[model samples]
Target chain A: MTTTDLAQSPAIPRDGDGPVFREPWEAAAFAMAVRLHERGLFTWKEWAATLSEEIAAAQDRGDPDHGDTYYRHWLAALERLVAAKGAVGPAEMTARRDAWDRAVRATPHGQPILLANDPRSCAHRP
Target chain B: MGAHHDHDHDHEERWSEVELRVKALESLLTEKGLVDPAALEVLIQTYETKVGPRNGAQVVARAWSDPAYKARLLEDATAAIAELGFTGRQGEDMVVVENTEAVHNLVVCTLCSCYPWPVLGLPPAWYKAAPYRARAVREPRAVLAEFGVAVPEEREVRVWDSTAELRYLVLPQRPPGTEGLDEGALAELVTRDSMIGVGEPLPPAGAAA
Candidate 1:
């Protein structure tokens, strides 16, 4: 098969005009979703549908819908979809989120943000 | 940058609310079996190594050398960029505005962080910070000043605010006395900040050295 065909068996995301990220994390999120889709974790259609739902829910909850913090919704949908797939428990996800919050709290500025070992141990880092 | 940075001393509190949340998700995903770290690294490396500011630099460098491509870039940036194989999410649509003797262009995403991904991989920290989001649209000249970009009195400064569907990348004017520099060297002079219009390209070799 042609390289382009293999690349597009799952169509690659096309960036709109301008730069793709306002922040580094947006690229990280964007990359994560693409990687997950490439692994057949979820189809792009599934991702789009779930993301639209998440955006709608946010708007319902008074998200100005200006596209500010849109990736927040993207992350939420990702979390929900991964949870739904049973790859990881939702409660476990929340606990990890807390761990990250704590990690950030403890990390001095300019140092790398690393999760504490306890949860990493519990979660089975490998 | 100096005054504001000094004012905000509790640097540990710097991770924005969204950054913290996203990091947590990444951590959880890696810690769990939901996502593969190696696959994630492939994606990250794709952007870091294969696609990013270098690609943007190549585009700018080509435009500097080829006027026809530059015209196409401005007229249909998306199509032109795709011709160079720089196409994907965050770069699905693009507008390449030129910085000329009479005009200077600056890019911002006041609403959210919308940028051209195929060219500039990820926006730097300051580009995504609250201060830039709040200040860019209100006072374009002052923001440029903070970045050390001086648009002379005769030239007008225009700020392009990006959204989900559209993004803008500034094509900085080629530096003077570089008629001898080849395209590769020209691309080397194209910095990420210059493409974003926050700063200018480096001086020519003799002048630079």
Candidate 2:
């Protein structure tokens, strides 16, 4: 493929000749959904249904729904499907979320937030 | 808050809360053995490197150069596109709409962002926005104008609404000066927006070489 022509336009996100993530988290969210579907966790149809439901829910919650949070809805749908398939429970997800929030706060800016950065994990490290 | 501290890290660059949430969820899933980071890496890499609008550009370019291929594309887009090796999920059903002097075609998905992914890659942000979805069909001339396309008063604009089962790709009218250009050079002129009918292909300038 020709890289020069594709790189000239800023409308689409291109990292080199391929599509680039506008943010790292968008890539993460996208991959998680596709991977889960690949593992037969849920059909693409089910995933689409869950995603539309999430988008509708967000619209009800006063989201502008102008597509800025498209991946946010995607992440929400993946979480919902993963939970529904008995892969993970709501409680575990919440606990992990809190742990991550803690880890995120503990890590210095520009550094990767490692799970070990969670102070609770550090506390348990005898 | 204005006190200068001797820290090496810049305070302004921090992960968004959503980013933290994704990392946390990934960590949780990985710990449970539900997902492997390596597998996720491969998936992301595939989309990043292997799939994108360049695929669509090639299809448009071939159609522009070969009348037989254009006939095949217009007749059976799915099979024609697959002949060029661009086929996968979300692109099983395909429709190629052509733009002529008297007719222009535009595409949108009113319900959600249903796009021809195997060819076009991911739909752009605006394509998924509520306003575009709602307005592209209702007032396509106005929408096209916003994208810097001013269709003449006599030409008719048709809108194709893509769905989960079917997707549309616009065959933009080739510019006048591109007759001498080869297929590869022609592909260079086919932008992502042109195939979506929001804009026209790049005019042959330095591309004729």
Candidate 3:
């Protein structure tokens, strides 16, 4: 705690003493991590380690840590921990991610994007 | 069976890659039964609405108005905060440090953002960033200056590094001219930054108006 890292710290996005969520995804990512933790998927200790590792990796890769990508690292950590526990495979995650991308594109304006909206998921449905 | 629209890119075109990834992860987790969307919603609702600085504010107010409660808070923060109904994850262990005329206390997580979520909600973005984490312990006075706090030369600054096992909440010095204020009014003066030791509570002048 005494050692000085001297890296950049971002200003908090404050809405009168309340933490701000710039996007719905940010809140969702945060909630997902907490929910997973509550479900006993990974200890908070493990999650903290994974997140610290992710930030360190990004810092090594020249991420300024400007604060916006904090949750990106958070999501990455969650995914890594979840995958490491064998709860979800990387390949399946990639496949599901693609399905979601297609589903988002398929969903009409102001409509909820469902997995069924993805043509691939629909075609693969038994 | 599909309803095709050539102009359907609008929904995701505005979305960032990380955003899509979050949605994808949530959907995938839900499908696998590893996540319950409703449960996720409840957690989000709790953080957004139920838990936050107000909880810590109430504790600070009570501590300010009541010596016995403050004694319990400083001695056993975990049970004391739970006594006020703020016991949960990220707050299983608690330490309440007092700020006095001679000593000012500041908290940061040098390893990561380990905060008392039950009391203060989420850690602010800056609290989690590398700069604050690295600098707070090293150059606390300068950091406090950045947060618009100026610690006099006579006062000592003590920095607390929070961890997953333990978290801290600073019980800021109760403001002067507030002896007559009730707990609720006193709570209103307890800002989140004050409890983090970055800023002081609202002065009575502001609270009066």
Please give the CA lDDT of all the candidate structures.
0.74, 0.81, 0.84
- TM-score of candidate 2 on Cα atoms, chains taken together: 0.81
Candidate achieving the largest lDDT? 3
For model 2, state the Cα shift of residue A113 in Å.
3.5
Model 1 segments more than 4 A misplaced: A1-30, A36-92, A95-126, B1-35
Count of steric clashes across candidates, in order: 25, 0, 0
For model 1, what share of native contacts is present? 0.29
Model 3 spans with C-alpha error above 4 angstroms? A1-19, A108-111, A123-126, B1-15, B206-209
The predicted structure with the larger TM-score, 1 or 2, is: 2
lDDT of 3 by residue, B1-209 (tens): 34455444455534567877787788878878878888888888888888899999999999999999999999999999999989999999899999999999999988778899999998787887777887788789878987889999999999999987889999999998997899999999999999999999999864553
Local accuracy of candidate 3 as per-residue lDDT tens digits, A1-126: 232433434443333554557677888988888888888999988999999899889888998675667888888898899899988778888887787788777667788777787878755488
lDDT tens digits, residue span A61-108, model 1: 976444446667777878788778776567886676677776666555
Best by TM-score: 3
In terms of lDDT, model 2 sits at 0.81
In model 3, pairs of residues that clash are none
Mark the 10 consecutive residues where model 3 chain B has the least summed lDDT.
B1-10
Error of 1 at B29 (Å): 6.8
DockQ of the candidate models in sequence: 0.15, 0.29, 0.49
